[model samples]
Target: MSSSIYSTRRWRKLRAAKLALQPLCEPCSRRGKLVPAYSVDHIKAIAAGGDPYPALDGLMSMCVSCHSIKTNARDNPHAFGKGWKAAFKGCDLDGRPLDPDHPFLASSEG
Candidate 1:
Protein backbone atom coordinates (compact mmCIF):
# COMPACT_ATOMS: atom_id res chain seq x y z
CA MET A 1 0.00 0.00 0.00
CA SER A 2 1.12 3.52 -0.69
CA SER A 3 2.13 5.57 2.36
CA SER A 4 0.12 8.47 0.92
CA ILE A 5 -2.95 7.03 2.61
CA TYR A 6 -1.35 7.71 5.98
CA SER A 7 -0.60 11.30 4.99
CA THR A 8 -4.34 12.10 4.84
CA ARG A 9 -5.78 14.61 7.31
CA ARG A 10 -8.28 12.08 8.65
CA TRP A 11 -5.51 9.58 9.24
CA ARG A 12 -3.42 12.22 10.95
CA LYS A 13 -6.20 12.96 13.39
CA LEU A 14 -6.78 9.27 14.08
CA ARG A 15 -3.05 8.67 14.53
CA ALA A 16 -2.77 11.52 17.02
CA ALA A 17 -5.68 10.21 19.04
CA LYS A 18 -4.29 6.67 18.98
CA LEU A 19 -0.85 7.81 20.17
CA ALA A 20 -2.39 9.92 22.91
CA LEU A 21 -4.41 7.02 24.23
CA GLN A 22 -1.54 4.55 24.06
CA PRO A 23 1.78 6.33 24.27
CA LEU A 24 3.74 3.14 24.76
CA CYS A 25 4.61 0.63 22.05
CA GLU A 26 2.18 -2.31 22.23
CA PRO A 27 4.65 -4.92 21.03
CA CYS A 28 7.38 -3.60 23.29
CA SER A 29 4.96 -3.65 26.19
CA ARG A 30 4.13 -7.28 25.42
CA ARG A 31 7.85 -8.03 25.46
CA GLY A 32 8.20 -6.31 28.89
CA LYS A 33 9.59 -3.03 27.57
CA LEU A 34 8.19 0.51 27.95
CA VAL A 35 9.33 2.39 24.86
CA PRO A 36 7.13 5.21 23.56
CA ALA A 37 5.10 4.53 20.45
CA TYR A 38 6.15 6.50 17.39
CA SER A 39 3.54 5.27 14.91
CA VAL A 40 0.05 3.88 14.67
CA ASP A 41 0.28 0.59 12.84
CA HIS A 42 -2.61 -1.30 11.30
CA ILE A 43 -3.06 -4.54 13.22
CA LYS A 44 -4.18 -6.22 10.05
CA ALA A 45 -1.57 -5.16 7.50
CA ILE A 46 -2.72 -3.00 4.58
CA ALA A 47 -1.00 -5.38 2.14
CA ALA A 48 -2.98 -8.38 3.41
CA GLY A 49 -6.46 -7.36 2.23
CA GLY A 50 -6.89 -4.98 5.15
CA ASP A 51 -8.90 -1.81 4.69
CA PRO A 52 -6.97 1.35 4.04
CA TYR A 53 -9.10 3.35 6.43
CA PRO A 54 -10.02 0.66 8.87
CA ALA A 55 -11.81 1.49 12.10
CA LEU A 56 -10.10 1.36 15.52
CA ASP A 57 -10.44 -2.43 15.51
CA GLY A 58 -7.34 -2.70 13.30
CA LEU A 59 -4.86 -0.30 14.83
CA MET A 60 -2.11 -0.40 17.44
CA SER A 61 0.77 1.71 18.70
CA MET A 62 4.30 0.85 17.58
CA CYS A 63 7.86 2.12 17.73
CA VAL A 64 9.79 2.56 14.47
CA SER A 65 12.11 -0.39 15.05
CA CYS A 66 9.32 -2.76 16.01
CA HIS A 67 7.23 -1.52 13.10
CA SER A 68 10.06 -2.27 10.66
CA ILE A 69 10.48 -5.75 12.06
CA LYS A 70 6.75 -6.41 11.79
CA THR A 71 6.63 -5.11 8.23
CA ASN A 72 9.66 -7.14 7.17
CA ALA A 73 8.12 -10.29 8.66
CA ARG A 74 4.89 -9.71 6.78
CA ASP A 75 6.60 -8.83 3.51
CA ASN A 76 8.91 -11.85 3.62
CA PRO A 77 7.18 -14.78 5.26
CA HIS A 78 9.53 -17.18 3.52
CA ALA A 79 12.41 -15.80 5.58
CA PHE A 80 10.83 -17.26 8.66
CA GLY A 81 10.31 -20.67 7.07
CA LYS A 82 12.14 -23.73 8.50
CA GLY A 83 14.81 -24.01 5.83
CA TRP A 84 15.40 -20.25 5.77
CA LYS A 85 15.77 -20.09 9.53
CA ALA A 86 18.42 -22.80 9.44
CA ALA A 87 20.33 -21.00 6.70
CA PHE A 88 20.03 -17.72 8.55
CA LYS A 89 21.78 -19.27 11.54
CA GLY A 90 25.00 -19.29 9.54
CA CYS A 91 24.90 -15.54 8.81
CA ASP A 92 26.99 -12.93 10.61
CA LEU A 93 24.83 -11.29 13.20
CA ASP A 94 26.33 -7.81 12.79
CA GLY A 95 26.80 -7.78 9.04
CA ARG A 96 24.73 -5.60 6.76
CA PRO A 97 22.43 -7.67 4.56
CA LEU A 98 23.73 -7.42 0.98
CA ASP A 99 22.31 -10.60 -0.51
CA PRO A 100 18.94 -10.21 -2.22
CA ASP A 101 18.56 -13.96 -2.60
CA HIS A 102 19.07 -14.73 1.09
CA PRO A 103 17.16 -12.64 3.57
CA PHE A 104 19.55 -13.11 6.50
CA LEU A 105 22.96 -13.50 4.87
CA ALA A 106 25.10 -10.53 3.84
CA SER A 107 26.86 -11.49 0.61
CA SER A 108 30.54 -10.59 0.52
CA GLU A 109 30.44 -10.70 -3.30
CA GLY A 110 28.39 -7.56 -3.27
Candidate 2:
Protein backbone atom coordinates (compact mmCIF):
# COMPACT_ATOMS: atom_id res chain seq x y z
CA MET A 1 0.00 0.00 0.00
CA SER A 2 1.11 3.54 -0.73
CA SER A 3 1.44 6.23 1.92
CA SER A 4 -1.51 8.53 2.60
CA ILE A 5 0.32 11.44 1.00
CA TYR A 6 0.64 9.53 -2.23
CA SER A 7 -3.11 8.93 -2.29
CA THR A 8 -3.86 12.62 -2.28
CA ARG A 9 -5.30 14.25 -5.43
CA ARG A 10 -2.55 16.86 -5.42
CA TRP A 11 0.15 14.24 -5.34
CA ARG A 12 -1.53 12.25 -8.10
CA LYS A 13 -1.63 15.25 -10.37
CA LEU A 14 2.00 16.06 -9.67
CA ARG A 15 2.99 12.47 -10.34
CA ALA A 16 1.18 12.42 -13.66
CA ALA A 17 2.73 15.67 -14.72
CA LYS A 18 6.20 14.46 -13.79
CA LEU A 19 5.76 11.24 -15.76
CA ALA A 20 4.48 13.15 -18.76
CA LEU A 21 7.46 15.49 -18.60
CA GLN A 22 9.99 12.69 -18.38
CA PRO A 23 8.69 9.39 -19.69
CA LEU A 24 12.04 7.63 -19.34
CA CYS A 25 13.55 6.47 -16.07
CA GLU A 26 15.95 9.26 -15.10
CA PRO A 27 18.62 7.02 -13.62
CA CYS A 28 18.40 4.50 -16.43
CA SER A 29 18.63 7.26 -18.95
CA ARG A 30 21.77 8.57 -17.28
CA ARG A 31 23.19 5.09 -17.65
CA GLY A 32 22.45 5.13 -21.38
CA LYS A 33 19.38 2.89 -21.07
CA LEU A 34 15.93 3.59 -22.47
CA VAL A 35 13.59 2.18 -19.83
CA PRO A 36 10.09 3.55 -19.48
CA ALA A 37 9.23 5.22 -16.18
CA TYR A 38 6.86 3.33 -13.88
CA SER A 39 6.59 5.86 -11.09
CA VAL A 40 7.46 9.35 -9.95
CA ASP A 41 9.79 9.69 -6.98
CA HIS A 42 10.77 12.72 -4.96
CA ILE A 43 14.43 13.57 -5.48
CA LYS A 44 14.50 14.54 -1.86
CA ALA A 45 12.14 12.46 0.22
CA ILE A 46 9.54 14.30 2.27
CA ALA A 47 10.66 12.44 5.39
CA ALA A 48 14.08 13.96 4.82
CA GLY A 49 12.61 17.48 4.89
CA GLY A 50 11.91 17.93 1.21
CA ASP A 51 8.92 19.88 0.03
CA PRO A 52 5.94 17.61 -0.55
CA TYR A 53 5.01 19.49 -3.68
CA PRO A 54 8.34 20.48 -5.12
CA ALA A 55 8.89 21.59 -8.69
CA LEU A 56 9.18 19.08 -11.56
CA ASP A 57 12.97 19.13 -11.36
CA GLY A 58 12.72 17.98 -7.77
CA LEU A 59 10.96 14.79 -8.87
CA MET A 60 12.38 11.83 -10.71
CA SER A 61 10.74 9.41 -13.12
CA MET A 62 11.81 5.84 -12.39
CA CYS A 63 11.14 2.33 -13.58
CA VAL A 64 9.81 -0.15 -11.00
CA SER A 65 13.19 -1.82 -10.53
CA CYS A 66 15.10 1.41 -9.98
CA HIS A 67 12.37 2.74 -7.71
CA SER A 68 12.47 -0.42 -5.62
CA ILE A 69 16.23 -0.31 -5.34
CA LYS A 70 16.27 3.37 -4.32
CA THR A 71 13.39 2.93 -1.86
CA ASN A 72 14.98 -0.10 -0.23
CA ALA A 73 18.26 1.71 0.07
CA ARG A 74 16.76 4.86 1.55
CA ASP A 75 14.00 3.42 3.75
CA ASN A 76 15.78 0.27 4.87
CA PRO A 77 19.38 1.27 5.16
CA HIS A 78 20.07 -1.07 8.08
CA ALA A 79 19.19 -4.13 6.03
CA PHE A 80 20.77 -3.07 2.76
CA GLY A 81 23.60 -0.96 4.16
CA LYS A 82 24.49 2.64 3.39
CA GLY A 83 26.15 1.67 0.11
CA TRP A 84 22.92 0.31 -1.32
CA LYS A 85 22.35 3.43 -3.35
CA ALA A 86 25.45 2.55 -5.34
CA ALA A 87 24.59 -1.15 -5.50
CA PHE A 88 23.32 -1.17 -9.05
CA LYS A 89 25.71 -3.34 -11.00
CA GLY A 90 27.56 -2.43 -14.19
CA CYS A 91 28.80 0.80 -15.73
CA ASP A 92 27.97 3.01 -18.66
CA LEU A 93 29.69 2.82 -22.07
CA ASP A 94 32.43 5.18 -21.03
CA GLY A 95 33.20 3.16 -17.90
CA ARG A 96 31.41 5.64 -15.64
CA PRO A 97 29.28 4.53 -12.73
CA LEU A 98 25.65 3.94 -13.62
CA ASP A 99 24.42 5.38 -10.34
CA PRO A 100 24.65 9.15 -10.35
CA ASP A 101 24.86 9.10 -6.57
CA HIS A 102 27.97 6.92 -6.64
CA PRO A 103 30.73 7.96 -4.30
CA PHE A 104 33.05 8.43 -7.24
CA LEU A 105 30.88 11.24 -8.57
CA ALA A 106 30.36 12.68 -5.13
CA SER A 107 34.09 12.87 -4.57
CA SER A 108 34.61 14.44 -7.96
CA GLU A 109 32.17 17.24 -7.20
CA GLY A 110 34.71 18.94 -5.00
Candidate 3:
Protein backbone atom coordinates (compact mmCIF):
# COMPACT_ATOMS: atom_id res chain seq x y z
CA MET A 1 0.00 0.00 0.00
CA SER A 2 0.96 3.67 0.30
CA SER A 3 3.84 4.56 2.60
CA SER A 4 2.06 7.51 4.22
CA ILE A 5 -1.00 5.43 4.98
CA TYR A 6 1.19 2.81 6.50
CA SER A 7 2.90 5.47 8.55
CA THR A 8 -0.41 6.76 9.85
CA ARG A 9 -1.68 3.32 10.86
CA ARG A 10 1.61 2.60 12.51
CA TRP A 11 1.49 5.81 14.48
CA ARG A 12 -2.02 5.12 15.70
CA LYS A 13 -1.24 1.61 16.87
CA LEU A 14 1.90 2.82 18.61
CA ARG A 15 0.07 5.61 20.38
CA ALA A 16 -2.69 3.25 21.40
CA ALA A 17 -0.20 0.81 22.83
CA LYS A 18 1.56 3.58 24.73
CA LEU A 19 -1.73 4.67 26.25
CA ALA A 20 -2.58 1.12 27.21
CA LEU A 21 0.77 0.65 28.89
CA GLN A 22 0.46 3.83 30.87
CA PRO A 23 1.65 3.60 34.53
CA LEU A 24 3.66 0.53 33.56
CA CYS A 25 6.57 1.83 31.57
CA GLU A 26 8.49 -1.05 30.00
CA PRO A 27 11.86 0.55 30.63
CA CYS A 28 11.00 1.08 34.25
CA SER A 29 9.56 -2.41 34.65
CA ARG A 30 12.75 -3.82 33.23
CA ARG A 31 14.65 -1.83 35.82
CA GLY A 32 12.32 -3.11 38.54
CA LYS A 33 10.66 0.27 38.94
CA LEU A 34 6.95 1.09 38.61
CA VAL A 35 6.48 4.48 37.04
CA PRO A 36 4.12 5.89 34.43
CA ALA A 37 5.46 5.54 30.96
CA TYR A 38 5.30 8.52 28.61
CA SER A 39 7.94 8.10 25.92
CA VAL A 40 8.09 5.41 23.26
CA ASP A 41 11.38 3.92 22.20
CA HIS A 42 12.56 2.93 18.74
CA ILE A 43 14.71 -0.18 18.58
CA LYS A 44 16.54 1.40 15.70
CA ALA A 45 16.44 5.09 14.88
CA ILE A 46 16.05 6.92 11.59
CA ALA A 47 19.49 8.49 12.05
CA ALA A 48 21.09 5.10 12.54
CA GLY A 49 20.96 4.57 8.77
CA GLY A 50 17.69 2.65 9.09
CA ASP A 51 14.20 2.82 7.61
CA PRO A 52 11.67 5.52 8.53
CA TYR A 53 9.11 3.16 10.04
CA PRO A 54 7.44 3.86 13.38
CA ALA A 55 8.67 1.48 16.03
CA LEU A 56 6.08 -1.22 16.74
CA ASP A 57 6.87 -3.46 19.72
CA GLY A 58 10.10 -1.60 19.94
CA LEU A 59 7.90 1.32 20.89
CA MET A 60 8.34 1.02 24.64
CA SER A 61 6.78 3.58 27.00
CA MET A 62 9.31 5.31 29.19
CA CYS A 63 9.78 8.67 30.86
CA VAL A 64 10.95 11.47 28.55
CA SER A 65 14.37 11.46 30.16
CA CYS A 66 14.61 7.68 29.98
CA HIS A 67 13.64 7.76 26.34
CA SER A 68 16.31 10.35 25.58
CA ILE A 69 18.85 8.40 27.56
CA LYS A 70 17.90 5.20 25.71
CA THR A 71 18.23 6.93 22.37
CA ASN A 72 21.57 8.31 23.44
CA ALA A 73 22.56 4.84 24.54
CA ARG A 74 21.67 3.44 21.14
CA ASP A 75 23.70 6.18 19.45
CA ASN A 76 26.65 5.95 21.81
CA PRO A 77 27.91 2.93 23.77
CA HIS A 78 30.72 3.41 26.26
CA ALA A 79 28.74 6.27 27.73
CA PHE A 80 25.21 4.76 27.72
CA GLY A 81 25.10 1.80 25.35
CA LYS A 82 27.70 -0.08 27.29
CA GLY A 83 27.70 -3.92 27.61
CA TRP A 84 24.64 -4.86 29.70
CA LYS A 85 23.16 -1.45 29.14
CA ALA A 86 23.39 -2.03 25.40
CA ALA A 87 21.48 -5.27 25.83
CA PHE A 88 18.64 -3.58 27.73
CA LYS A 89 18.86 0.04 26.55
CA GLY A 90 20.08 -0.67 23.05
CA CYS A 91 18.05 -3.23 21.09
CA ASP A 92 14.44 -4.37 21.30
CA LEU A 93 13.32 -7.81 22.34
CA ASP A 94 12.74 -10.57 19.82
CA GLY A 95 9.26 -12.00 19.03
CA ARG A 96 6.48 -9.47 18.62
CA PRO A 97 4.22 -9.26 21.69
CA LEU A 98 1.14 -8.76 19.52
CA ASP A 99 0.41 -10.64 16.35
CA PRO A 100 -0.68 -7.48 14.53
CA ASP A 101 2.66 -5.86 15.26
CA HIS A 102 5.85 -7.67 16.12
CA PRO A 103 7.10 -7.18 19.68
CA PHE A 104 10.26 -5.61 18.30
CA LEU A 105 10.02 -3.54 15.16
CA ALA A 106 13.26 -3.10 13.32
CA SER A 107 14.00 0.45 12.19
CA SER A 108 15.03 -1.10 8.91
CA GLU A 109 12.11 -1.95 6.62
CA GLY A 110 13.71 -4.93 5.00
How far does residue 64 in candidate 2 sit from its true spot (Å)?
Answer: 0.7
Model 1: lDDT equals 0.64
Please say which candidate is ahead in TM-score: 1 or 3.
Answer: 1
Best by lDDT: 2
> Residue by residue across 1-110, what tens digits does model 1's lDDT show?
56788889999988888888899987566556799999898765577666767776467788887676656655788644443233223323345331123533224436
Error of 2 at 45 (Å): 0.8
If ranked by lDDT, best first, what sequence of candidates would result?
Answer: 2, 1, 3
User: What TM-score against the true fold does each predicted structure earn?
Assistant: 0.63, 0.74, 0.48
Q: Write the per-residue lDDT of candidate 3 for residues 1-110, one digit (tens) a residue.
A: 32353358666676676658564667556556677777655544445543545545545567766666665755566675353254354332442232112234333346
Show pairs that collide, candidate 2. Answer: none
Candidate 3 clash total?
3
Q: Where does candidate 1 stray beyond 4 Å?
A: 80-110
For 9-99, candidate 2 gives per-residue lDDT tens digits of 9999999999999999988887778999999988667876778889998888999888888888877768464444565555767777756
By TM-score, how accurate is candidate 3?
Answer: 0.48
* Global lDDT of each candidate: 0.64, 0.79, 0.53
Clashing residue pairs in candidate 3, if any?
96-102, 96-103, 97-103
